[model samples]
Target: MEHVYIGLGSNLADPAEQLRNAVQALGQLPDSVLVGVSAFYQSDSLLPGQPRYTNAVVALDSDLAPLALLDALQAIEIDQGRERHERWGPRTLDLDILLFGDRLIDEPRLKVPHYHMQARPFVLYPLAELAPVDLQLADGRTLKALLADCPFVGLERLPH
Candidate 1:
């Protein structure tokens, strides 16, 4: 099984509970086992006019391929009432494939390492908690180094 990192966020309908339920759903993916989940964070919405979000990162060991994993994630989002009407819109639940076992993919439907991970602390801080110290980007930069340059502020770790 390959290691995979997934970013989860919710801004509607009890955001924290939405994320908690999503994490539980992730553990039920076919051929996958959830390894860990970072602490929930309350962060400002990245896009204007949206409510605050509860964010987290989850680690998993999965035998599914990247595209398959993407499909599964989308399915989970749909199950959680996610809508795609607007880019960066408020979501009931959002699931993004952040890193797929060091694979770099640029397809019409998916991108590995999440094209914008480095710029968002909501993703990076939680991801750093679950990723290895030696984890490197496709360009060979370490996750820790990329996090150093992230300017996103106002992330607060939620109490357990």
Candidate 2:
């Protein structure tokens, strides 16, 4: 099995609950086992006119290849009534593949070790928690430190 990290977010229909359900749902996909999930965070919407988003990151051990994992994540979003009408649009659930075993894949349909990952507090905060073993950077700084250094606010850790 390969180590995979996924970023999750939701802004509609009980945002925190939506994130929780997505995490539970992801665990059931074939060839996958959820290893860790970070605390839920409420953040300002990245998209214009959208509601606040509850964000998280989940760690997993999975046999699926990168493309396959992307497909599975999309299926979960679809299951949650997500519709992609615009970039960064409102979502019932959003899943992003943040890392896939250090494989560094880039393709038309998928990118492992998600680009713009470290730039987003929502992604870094949760990923740092879920992948406690690996931490968030090759550099010495921590996710929490990066978060503090950045301008984003209102990050809080929570239990499942």
Which candidate has the highest TM-score of all? 1
What is candidate 1's lDDT per residue for 28-147, written digit by digit as tens? 999999999999999889787889999999999999999999898899899888889988788999999888887888998998879878888999999989987678976577897888
Error of 2 at 11 (Å): 0.5
What is the lDDT of every predicted structure here? 0.90, 0.81
lDDT of 2 by residue, 29-117 (tens): 89999998888888778766889888999989999988888998999899888999977788899999988875767798876567777
Mark the 10 consecutive residues where model 1 has the least summed lDDT.
132-141
Candidate 2 global lDDT = 0.81
Please list the residue runs of candidate 1 whose C-alpha ends up more than 4 Å from where it truly belongs after superposition: none
Clashing residue pairs, candidate 1? Answer: none
In order of appearance, the predictions have TM-scores of 0.96, 0.86
How far in Å is the alpha carbon of 132 misplaced in model 2?
Answer: 3.5
Error of model 2, residue 108, in angstroms: 1.0
* Model 2 misplaced regions, further than 4 Å: 133-160
